[model samples]
Structure formats: C-alpha cells, structure tokens
Target chain A: MIISEMAFFLLVTGALILTVLAPVVLIGLFIKDYFSKSIW
Target chain B: MTEFALDTQTALFIIVGFALAWIAFGVWLGRKNKSHEDFALAGRNVGYAFAAATAMATWVTSNTTLVAPQLTYQLGVWGMVGYSFAALGLLLFAPMAKRIKQILPQGYTSGDFIRLRYGRFAWAVFLVISVVYAFGWLVSLGMAGGILLEALSGLDYYIGMTIILAMCVGYTLFGGLRAVIATDFIQALIIILGVAVVAYWLIDNVGLTSIHTELSHAHPQLLDLLFPAAVMFLFNNIFFGLGEIFHSNVWWSRALSFRKNVAYKAYLTGGLLWLPIPIVTGFIALAAPQLGIFPASADMIGPAVASSVLGKTGAILVFIVVFSALASSLDSLLAASSDLVTQDIYHKLIKKNASDQQLMRFNRYCILSLGVMTWLLCLPRVATLGALLNFAGAFVASTIWPIVIGLYWRRLQGIFAGIAMAAGTIVGLVAYFWIGFYVAALVSCAVSGLICAIGVVFNKSQFSWHQLQENEQ
Candidate 1:
C-alpha cells in the first residue's frame, strides 16, 4: 500500500501549481470589486 | 543553550515592526466603524475579495502551518492528506452559510441562532462547548507563537507569547472584525507565497525523487497509504474539522458579515484555495529525514527544516509567515469570541437594554480581557499543540449533529438537542481518555448523530423557521 513515486510527485507539484494561482485569483477579484465599488 | 536559527535581536525587530504596522492598519480601518454592527460584523456588508481571503486565511491557522508539518513528521503521507480534508469543513459550510444569511439576516453570533432555535438549555450547552473549544484553540495559537519564536530565534517563550497576544488584542480592540479581515487578506498572501518558495526550494535542492527513495528505504511507513494509525486518524480529523467550522462563531460571524450573495461563493473559493496549503506545508517535513534534521519536538519540524535549509534569511521568512498565520486566526478568534461574550452573554443575558454604543464599547473590553486571559493560560505551555486541539475535538464534535439537524430539520426539539450535545460530549470524553485522541471526534459525532436521529424520529413538534429572525433591542 505504498504511495508510488509518481503519485507523490504529482500531489506536491499539483498543490504547488494551485498555490501559485491563489494570489492571482484573489487579487483579480479585488481589482474587480474595487472597480465595481463592491468591496466593503 | 540550543543554537537558534535567527538571533534574538533580528526577531525582536521583525516582531515590533510588524506589530506597529498592523495596529496602524487596524486604526485606519476602525475610522468607519460607527455602530456595533460595523465593528463586530464589518458592517455586515463585506465583499467577495476580503470575505474570501479572511475565510481562507483564518482557516490557515497554527494548525495548518505548525501542526500539519508535525503530523506529517509523525503520521507520514496520510497526516497531510488527512489534514487537507479539513477543507471539506469549509466547502460544506458554504451552503450553510447561505442558509444562515437567509434565516438569521440580523444574527450577531452562532449563539443567537442556537438560543432562538433551541431555547435556553440548548443554548447553555452550546455556549459551554463554544467556550471550551475557543479557549482551547486560543491557547494553542498563543503557545504556538511562543514555541515558534523560541524554536526559530532563541527568543524567550513568555515574551514572544505576550507580544503576539497583545498585538492581536490591540488591533482587534481598535478595528474589530474589519481589522481582522483586512489583516487576514494580507496575511493570506504572505503565508501562501512563503510556503510556496520553501517547497520549491526543497524540491529543487533536495529533489523529490531522492527524498522518496530515502523514505522508501528508511521510513517505508511514511509512504504507506494504508498505515493503520494514519487510517484511523483520517475520519477523526475530518469530524474534528467539521465540528470546528460547523459549531464555531468564527465561521458563522464571517457568514453574517459578508454581503447578501457573497458567503457561499466566498467560502467555496476560500476552501478551494485552502485545500492545497496543508500539503505544501506538510511536504516540508517529508524532507527532514533526508536533510538529517530532527526537531526537539514534533511541532517544531516545519520551522526547523526551513530555517536550516535557507539559513538566516529563511528563519526571518518563516518567522514573518508564521507570525502572519498565527495573527490572522488569533485576531479573528479574539474578535469572534469577544462578540460571542458581548452579544450572546452580555446583551442577551445581562444587558438586555444596552444601546449599540454600549455594546460596541463592551466588545472592545471583552477583546482586551480575552487576550489577557489567554496570555495567562498560555504562560504554562500546557499540552503540545496537537494534543490540546484534539481534546477540544471531543467537545466540539458533539455539537455537529445538533447544529446541522437544527438548521435544516423541523422535528428536532430543543430539549433533545441539549441532551444530545451533553450526552455526546460525555461519551466522547470517555472515548478520548479510554481509546485515543484519534477516536474522540469520531465517537463524539457518532453518539451525537444517533441521539439527533432518535430525537428527529420521536419528536412531535415542528420548529418554525421564523423564530430565527431575532430582533435587536
């Protein structure tokens, strides 16, 4: 029941990629909210 | 004396500088808070960006940054993956958040809903559970701050703990929920980017392939997907997380604070963003064996590894990131718990005719008092971060079924709900002491659910949903 090396690599790398995208999405939302005057 | 990653002076400088900056930011945000509603619920009109960030960041707590790595070091792959399942709590709460907004549009705390929906006995039971879990979490975060500073920079535990507690209480006193959320947005960014850099460094320098090979040869259990203890821990951790979010005012206050249409999407997005974080933090511990860096205690593994690999620069980075992580949740808890005491206990119980201005003033005092109480409790160090949290798991998990059923079902009566929580908590504590921390939440949730089912089946009266619309004095 050992996790394969490929699985381990994929888990960490996929998480990293998603982690990288978080700031982009958050800031983009902020910009959209700022323009719309909806950010309270 | 043990060698530290950063010298004491630099750590103190970073702490003082960040403390001043955040307190100033809080004061700036406080300018618009004209009423108790504005201070406690961010005017109950928070937007998607800040709402989403606060949800994500507050969830990221000492547990994710500190305990995730510690669990990974102790339980292997399952620990981190199991930790990530906590995101399910946030994800599932999205719909409930929407329901809460619709049901209790003017709700101040989770206590309001419980008291209105289930009456005094159930509300009393709920407040007890909430108080126990809140203090458990508050003390854990406080201890973690001291532990982290001590571990990374050779700072005194007492000083570090006091400074972090005072800093959070100071800002929360100034700005309330507005300060908590705004600071959380920035802290969220620092935490994400900090961990990403450290993980990337590890993968580049240590190489995952080599690290995996080392684990396979030396610590095969870490790579074992079906490791017995880890498997047992999986569901318990999920239940613990569910209970934490489901019953705590931390999430509920956020729900009430966000704009009409924002709670669901904000929580969904926050949960999605939060899902990968524990994995990134936990992966740091997997590299420890290869680096031959063992920590004095399991909880120190994350900081110890990062500081050792990246040297002085990394220590500062870890300090700032961890500080931000601790503060994000610490301030929210301070504000949320204070709101619980002020709105639920003080206004509803003692000061029924208190004005909005008076409530606002009392809430600030509550925040100050909670900080001092937490500081005094944290002075003793007590249990390891993980142990203290899991103990709270027993108490909070019992409220899970009661809260869920009370929300959607009409047949569950207040008396039965109160009994369910009380009996479930008793049984759960029995299991926690007799079995293990891994089984506490599972056993508690199960017992509570069973009682809720019986109550649902046998109870004759239907609850009117309109009762939740509690009017302010």
Candidate 2:
C-alpha cells in the first residue's frame, strides 16, 4: 500500500502534531489530579 | 508463501543481529535482580523514558498494520481516523498513573485492588474477565509471531510459533519484568525510528502528484472523512482500549515496576509517543494504489511496501520491527498474566498464607504454565488476526463500565459491581456474533451501569464510599 505525498504529509503531520502534544495533555491531567479530591 | 524481493539470508542476518544485541542488553539488566519485587516490577525503579516507550510500543502492534488498512480500504478515511481515537485510552490513563502509584503504593497486581476494595466476589468476577481477556491477547501475539514468520521466512507456522513463544517465555521467566521493560524500551525505539524513516522514504519516492491522481481516479473512498461505520469506529475503539487498560491489572503491575516519579513521567510520555503508530502503519496501506501493489491484506502491506521500496534490506528491517514488536508485547503479556495467576488465583485460592518467597517461587511456575496454555491456544489459525482480536474487544467492552465505576463511584455496591461484570460479559458475548462492536460496548456498559445505578438507588445494603476509596490516592 502506498499513500500520496499530500495524504502522507497530512497523516504524518497530524500524527506528529498529536505525538508532540500527547505529553502536554498528560501533564495537564497530572496537575489536575494533584488538586482533585474525588473518590476515584 | 509470499516471496519478497530481498534475499532470505540477508534478512535473517540483520534480524539476528538486532535480536542478539537487545537480548544481551536485557540479560545484563537482569543480573542485578535480587528480590521478588525486582523480578515482578523492576524493583519499582524504571524511569519515565523506559515506561513511556514500552507502553507505546506494546499497544501499536500488527493490528495497526493489519487491521487499520482493512478499515481504510473498506470504510474510507473515517476508518483510519476513527481508529486514532484509541489514543484516548492512554490520555485518560494519564492521571491514573499517579493514582495507581499512590493508592497501591505497595500493590503488586490489578487483582490487589479488587481484593482490598471490592471484596471476594468482586475480585472473583474481575479475575475471570481479566484472565479471559489477557489469554486472548497473548494468543493474538503468538498468532502474529507465527504468521509473520511464515510470511517473512517461509518457516512452517508451528515451528515459527514454538521458537518465538519459547524464546519470549524463557527470557521473561528468567529475568522477569526487569528484562521485559529494558528490551521493551529498545524495541520501542526501533519501531518509532523505523516507521518514521519508511514513511518519509515512501513519500519521497511516490511523489504527491502521482498519488493524488491515482487515488482519486481509483479509490476515491480514501478521501471520505466520515464513512458509514463512523459511530462504531469512533466510540467503540476508544471505549475498548480504555476498558482493556483500566480493568486489567497488567498495566498497573507493570506501572508499579517503575519508580514513582518515573512511572508518572513514562505513562505521560508513552501516551503521547503512542499517538503516531496507527497513522504510520495504517497510512502505508493507504498508499497502496500509487505503489502498484494493492494490499492483498492490510496486515501484509507493511512487509510488502518495505520489500518493494527499500528492496531486500528494507524487507529485513520490516521483519525486525515486527519481530521486535511481537517480542516486546508477548513478554509483557506473559509476565503480567503469570503475575495475575500467582497473585490472584494461587494466592487467593491455593495458598492463603503463601510467603513472599513462596509466592515468588509459585510465580515462576505460573509464568511457564500460562505461557504454555497461551502458546497452545494461539497455535490454531483462529480465523484472521483482525476478526479474532475484534472478538476480544467485544468481550471486554462489557466489563469496562463496571471497572471504571467500581474505581470511582462511591455508591457502587460489591454485588452491583460483581453482577455488572458477569452480566456484561455474558450479554456482550451474545452481541459479538450478531452486532457491531459499538453496539456491543454501548449495550454492555449500559447493562452494567444500570445494575449499579439501581443498586445505588433502591438497595437496603449499606453503601460505603470506602468500597472504592480515594485513600492517599
């Protein structure tokens, strides 16, 4: 299977952007958890 | 058997080189292992980098390569995009990293929480679903090992399977989780770097002009953002992945192996890094029309493209990446499965007073026994890899709500939790042969949630918030 340059760029760029942001999102969750007092 | 353009001997040499190098590194890591804690959870010392890499690597498997493409081909663009929702599992689990390390500060297995928080019946219910889900997962890896070997090396499936399972089980049993995690980090690196390199190479070779012309003229479905399977893929996959991680003790037990700070860092990092996998592997299949190689099967596209693009050497690299993926994933499954059996089944049932020393001794046996059972089960064709795995997704989706609610909902009674999981699995299995996964998860979670909600509203049993406490966590 082969993808077009535009398609590949779109997919790879999207994936890369998400990958870069994954850590930031997790960090945000970590901070939120630190302050929360729910039962879970 | 499929014939790649690459020479078999060269491929073998390259793969052997990588495996031998990683095995040596992993063996060396295990030499300092002294305690059961060392054996099971890497003495709670793994750093964020190691944890993050292993988690990401393990979750992205042949499925991403095999199933993702099939979805793209059938459902169009939305299929590929829908699958991306699985990353939500890792993202949701981000805060769970801290909670697990904090609440189960001394916890060893997912089963530990059940016993302490939900009592014997709840523990028993959780154990059944977990074992079934885990065993199914182990079998899929074993199946992948054999299928890849047959595809790449023309080795007989059984011979390929036995060798793969034995090697994975041997190392994990010998060095335990410590060995598994170290090897996992390196394997994760190979997968990430290899996929990145190939994705770039393929794009350069194919060129954008030719691709757009070819795909639009032939498979215009590739451009469709929302296909008919939209609702099913979008919601069910996210729910399925989340349920698997949240309910099974496998991940937390693995998490506990890392040092507290490291575990948190690793999960956060792993969650993000894991985001690229589905696109990398799945999109390769999407490129099929331009390569003049229509994918006979979604799973075969990765190997085929590697062979076609980079010739024999690239094919060999693909093999190594897949092999590394299978090994990394299988070893963890073996380690975690055996840990559950030892900690839940044996300790709970056979030996109530088993000492740490005795437990460790029994755990070694559990590792081997579980490995053997899974090896036997996975040896069969079990239909296609995609179908077999989807079958599992349906089964576990039912248990998701019960687990999530049990963890967080204070009023969820023990009876409600236990009944919910049992009834959910039973109903979900019924849905499997008849309906789509989205319908199954939705129905099952609803069934379980309703039971728990009813218990909360009308039951005379004392509802203690302590049943699912936030103590220290």
Candidate 3:
C-alpha cells in the first residue's frame, strides 16, 4: 500500500516537471523558427 | 453551491478581451494568403516548430483538460494512465504521416487519400465516418467550453457556448490554417503553463502524500493497481485514441501542410510532449476529496477542484487553460472539416473546374456553416463529454485497419475495405448499445481488422502508390 502511494507521488512529480519543460522547449524552438523564417 | 470564483462581469470581460485579440491576430495572419493552397494547407511549407506545436496543441483538446480528470475520478489511477496512452496515437502516426506526405504531397485532406487510394464507394463510406467523428468532436468541444465557463464562473451555458464557437469560427475563417497554427503556438504555451502552475500549487499546498493517503482510506479503488474495470479501460481507451488520430482529417491536413522532412519528427515530439499532460491534469481530481469539493458531474471536477482550492486566481487560471485548449482544437476541426467539404464535396463532386480563388471563398463559407451547425447542437447541452466522444469510437475505430492496410498493403480492394468499415461500424454500435462504452473501440477495431485480413488474403488486385499522385492538380 505504501509502495503504491509512493509510486503515485513519483509519477505526479515527473509529470509536473515535464509539463513545465514542454512550453519552454516549444517557445525556444518557436524563437529559432521565427528568426529563420521557418514559421510559415 | 453555485458560487463563482470570479464575478460574472470580470469573467465576461476576460472572455471578450481574449476573443477579440485572437480574432485580430487571425486577421493579421490572413494577410499572407494569396492562393487556395495557402488558405487550406499553409502553402504546404510549415516549419518544424509550428508543425510540432500545432500537432501537440490541437491534440490537447478539452478531452485532455476535462475528460482526463473525469475518467480519473471514476476509473481511478488506471484511468489517468489509460488516458495518457492517447499519445501513442500521435507517436505511431509519425511514420504514417511521413508516408502520407510522400504519397500525396498535394493532398488537401484525408478524404482525398481515401478517394484516390480506394474508389468512390469506399470514399463515400469514409466520408460518413469522417463527418460523424468531426461533428462529434466539434460539438463536444463547444459543449466543453460552455461547461467549463459555467463550472468556474456561473456563466450561462448558452452564452458561453455561443461565444466560443463564434470566436473560433471568426479566427479560422479569417486566417485559415495559418491563423489556426499561429494561435495554436501561443495557445499551447498558455495551456501548458496554466496546467503546470495549478498542479504545482496543488502539490505545494495540499501535498501528494495527503492526497494519496486520503484516497487509500476513502477511495481505495482509485489507487488499486489491480482494479479490473480500469484494466479493461486501458486498452479500450488506447484503441479509441488510435482510431481518432488515424482517420481524422485534422491530423492528415497537418501532415499534408508541414514541410517535407518535418512531419515525422514533429509528430514524434508532439506525442512525447503530450504524453504527461493527462497525468498532470488528472492528478488534480485525486485531490478533490481532500479539498472537500464534490462536483455535480465528473467532467466539472477539474475546474471545481482548482477553483475551490486556489480561489479566484486558480479559477482565472483554469478558465484560460481550458479556454485555450478548447479553441486550439475547435479551430483545427473547423479548418480541417471545412477542407474536407470544400475539397472533397465541392471541388471534386460539384464543380471540378472551380478556380483557386473560388475554392478558397467556398472553404470560408463551409467554416461559417459548420460553426453555426455546431452551435445549434451545443445549445441543448446533450451528453457528457466522455459519453459523446466514446460514441464516436464505434465509428472511427472501424477505419483503423482499413486505413493502415490501405496505406501499406496493395491486396485490399476498395469493395472489401468499404464493406469492412460499414459492417464494423454497425457491429460496434450494436456492442456499444448492448455491452458498454469501454468495449466500443476494441470491438470495432477487431471486427474491422478481421475483415481487412480476409480482403488481403483473397483480393488479387495490386494498388500502385503512383495512383495517389496522379489525380492531384
């Protein structure tokens, strides 16, 4: 039971980190694409 | 219990402000349009960044924002994980998208591929499935927009639904695919950031330990790894996702529009980025019991929990994120569905020689008409989002095997493919009525796959890939 609980928390934490990073990476790529006229 | 986090006036102000801004942005983007190809396919030169962002953002619809939590609330931990498996649809489509681009570089919609690859009979059956799924999705998003507003701010369902439909239709009509993709980029950022903020706040304040403990004591099934129903749902949800992506023009149009080399990697990256979103969104529902908030409906639990815990600020955040998610999907459906109607129905069937300028104008009209039709369906506030979307599973799943085999294998003839889709859908709908929602997609896919296999074994005709390239102007 405790193991299950711990696993849930670990998954949530990982998901949170990924969620935050998604936008940053997308925005970074957007800037690069925009400057290069690749945004079309 | 109808208390609002943000006052009605403030909510309306924000909604109106955002709607106007998006419409203006769409009009600005429309200035670059010079031909029908630019209008429908973004001139077929979309870059890696925009392509990836559009694919990810469009896939992150009201389903991910709203239905993910709803399923988690009902089916427990397995539900969230099952919902996340939808990313597999996009992930698997990476290679298929590459093939689609290579085969039909000038293709405008999935209907074009079906028509050219198969024949008129299969094309007609495919259109019915496409229309049903497209309208199912469009109406669901419209209903979700209203449901989200009313859940968070006590807004009227009619008013909210009308505003969202009009706003999306406005932008998509003016800017075409360019506006849709461009706004999708910005909307994607807002959606991810908003979800991440609310989730982090929940973790910081309530703590996952308490959430897990509360569930174990009170809602143990939610945390149960061996929960039977949830296990069944895992595979069902996966097939539904696969069917939705495999046959939908929304993804096909994006595949057709993207620059040659970008389709495969864009879909791959988009799928990876989309994988964790449902987990993040659905995790909020597990905290609802700890916060002492119970929603009238499972679908409303996401906004209800966020607003109850974080107050006015959280309500505002939920509003923006859900609204962004809804618009990203709504605009894409409008653009893609309109492309299907204009290219397949209007250009191909009605007027073969319609000029490029005329086709572009006709496409805009189709967008307006589709918006109006969706608005009417949304006004009644029919079924819950989950029920409505799962119903579409019966129709879309039948296309999976036919589309997959049709793309790679040449032995499957159009007659068998058409019958397979038609018969599979009929049996799947029967199962949906008799058995349950969870098995609809699974049954549909299985039946269709069997039929397609039979077709491959017996049919002797060889399909040339060059046929797909021949008909395009």
**Index of the highest-DockQ prediction:** 1
Q: List the residue pairs that clash in candidate 3.
A: none
Per residue, candidate 3 scores C-alpha lDDT tens digits across B1-473 of 47888788878998899999999999999999999999999999999898999999999999999999999899888889999999999999999999999888888999998898889999999999999999999999999999988887788889989998999999999999999999999999999999999999999999998898899899898988778878778998899999999999999999999998999999999999999999999999989888898888889999988898899999999999999999999999999999999999999999999999999999999999999999998888779999999999999999999899988888899998899899889988998999888888989999999999999999887999888887885
Stretches > 4 Å off in candidate 3: A1-3
Q: Against the correct fold, how does model 3 do in TM-score?
A: 0.99
Question: Per-residue lDDT tens digits of candidate 2, residues B1-473?
Answer: 25745454654565456556655766777676677777788878765555676777767666665566666556555666667677777777767767777667777788877767667887888888887888878887888777766666666778777767777877787778888877776677676667666666776787546666677788875765544455466676776777777776667786777666666666666766776777766666667767777655556656666667877666667777778888888888888888888877887788978888787778889888887898789767766676676667755666666656655655666777788878877786677668765456555666777787786776665545443345313
Candidate 1 residue lDDT tens string, B2-38: 7888999999999999999999999999999999999
Stronger candidate by DockQ (1 vs 3):
1
**Candidate 2 Cα deviation (angstroms), residue B152:** 2.4
TM-score of chain A of 3: 0.80
Every candidate's DockQ is 0.94, 0.14, 0.69
Poorest stretch of ten by lDDT in candidate 3 chain B: B1-10
State residue B232's C-alpha deviation in candidate 1, in Å: 1.4
Best candidate, lDDT-wise?
A: 1
Candidate numbers, best TM-score first, in rank order: 1, 3, 2
